[model samples]
Target chain A: MDLALLARLNEERAARRAAVLVTDLQSNTQRLVLEKDIMADPLSALLSDALRMGKSGVVESDGHKVFLTVQAPVLRIIAIGAVHISQALVPMAKQLGHDVIIVDPREAFASPERFPDVPVHAEWPDVALPRLGADRYTAYLLLTHDPKIDDPALHFALKSDAFYIGALGSRKTHGKRVERLQTIGFDEHAIKRIHAPIGLNIGAISPAEIALSILGEITAKLRLKPDGTKIGN
Target chain B: MLATDDDLLRQAEEWRREGRGVALATVVETWGSAPRPVGSHLVIDAEGTFMGSVSGGCVEGAVVTEALDVIESGAPKLLEFGVADETAWQVGLSCGGRISVYVEKVT
Candidate 1:
């Protein structure tokens, strides 16, 4: 471990960014592993493969021992509505370690007084979605209940790499939404990516409970195992 | 694993100041169905006391033995284990996956 590399690793650790030290045992050399933005590190990439194969290990590093800790990256939730569900989901998602953003054109709903301490963007989806680059770690929820707002956001989301995209509506509304998406040239596979009537069926009645179900489903999808995997019930 | 980097360095330095020998074990590589991933670590003292794990419980015995040898010889050894690997199964890692472990005495 050279002083310069050690200093860099210390800086990353202080920032609480996930990092791994890869060391060559034969040569007694080490290198730090860090991603450009939010891609999986070598440890996570290896672990993801291991989790698929049900394997784990304690690989050695240049005379020093190294441990692979699975640190889940920060979950970003982009809510394109400032409705009741948004109000409920923001606090709930924050408690679950998600960086939540509520985007809407209504100043009355998207104001700081309404959603204190949470990021609010009073702009159209075309305007707001570009600023928030969707990645594998991000989940998009369109609860605007208006085609003019939700459809554009879904269009933007479909073009990105977001792992989960959900839109709020009844089955009839979603059916119409899907037709509109098809008219816009999204294929069936791309349309399948959207989780309509978003949220798990926990028999939720209120906005808060519904928000819980949505977050629950998001967690389930995020933590889903790679190869026909199921979480411990 | 319980101790942070600063804490581990401090403890190791204190032990060295007290004239105690220390050995550090690290996971170098893993292949095909191991219990822990690469980069797992464990540290041991001259008396064969150990902290942390490389394979949960499957390969600690061999790791400790290697650590003891590293401490004695003041040299490092790369240990490999798997169900396919002959030497590792005796130490109880008979689970069919291979792991490469490096044991070295820390100055």
Candidate 2:
């Protein structure tokens, strides 16, 4: 409740950066742990574990107990096309508490009738994506097969901190897409972030099934550790 | 809007700023039929003013009772409510679950 702590917490929230506040039970002392500063914190192990898992809890450490509350921004998904896959994906993402926005310049596909109660931007990805402020917490999906729609957004997304970037295409199509991105000066490292052939290899034939796998993949990436150094479940 | 962790923290902080002694009880761990997930918080003030819920209509009165003492004595309490425990029936967690809550005085 100190003015300094309150202001710092507000600043982090406003900037959409993640933070955690830990209150020591016995001493009644408290400290704020920003995601960026986690490595340097004394409770770095506990703090980073909580942040990575996106859950907070109390712990007994060195005979002292403290409660840590993580304050991460809501995960966001920016789908670049209002196509059939998006119709299934948007509602699923919303149900999982992700903020979803569909961006497509084509009005016919981006109509309210197709995506009822969902936020649709009938604007090009180049225009809509900038306004969305896609950050590290945001995931991007390029659904349109059109180079004009998906490629421009790729240029924006690859340069930014979007956590996940996926494009819908077959393996051969993705190879060609990779070639195009390479010609545009995208390196192998940057382009590798895109999960082309879009969803997980769950043999999904229907749009809804594909949507399920894509969300499953996203959640796996979001929740699980690649090196399997997962902390608290 | 659904109350988030930050929202409850802010409410507890604001209450402390307003010269009210506040106790924060957070569900630290749970097992079996624990309705509330870990990290869920309930903020209680000196007069028993509160925001958020640590349990879904179960065992909150006991938590609030302990919170009042936390506010008075400036000490924190680690409380465990469970169907296996003696106070579970009195606490009303009849769903056969164990929940560990940590209550602390937040100055």
True contacts kept of each: 0.20, 0.40
Scored against the true structure, residue A44 in model 2 reaches a CA lDDT of 93
Backbone steric clashes in candidate 1, count: 19
Cα lDDT tens digits, model 1, A44-123, are: 56545433332223444334454442233456898999888889888888777678989998778788887886889999
TM-score of candidate 2's chain B against its reference? 0.92
Positional deviation of A104 in candidate 1, in angstroms? 0.8
In model 2, where do residues sit more than 4 Å from their true spots?
A1-11, A59-63, A111-118, A227-233, B1-23, B31-34, B44-52, B68-76, B83-97, B105-107
lDDT per residue as tens, model 2, B1-107: 43575677778777887888888788887889888888898989999978888888688998999999989988678888887885444675778788988888776
**Which residue pairs show collisions in model 2?**
none
lDDT of 2 by residue, A1-233 (tens): 34467557767876889999887766767888889889999889988878767787777777887778787887888888899999988778878878788899999999989988678999998888898886789999999898889999999999998889999988898888899999989998999899988888999999999999899889877866777554454
Best by DockQ: 2
Name the lDDT of candidate 1: 0.72
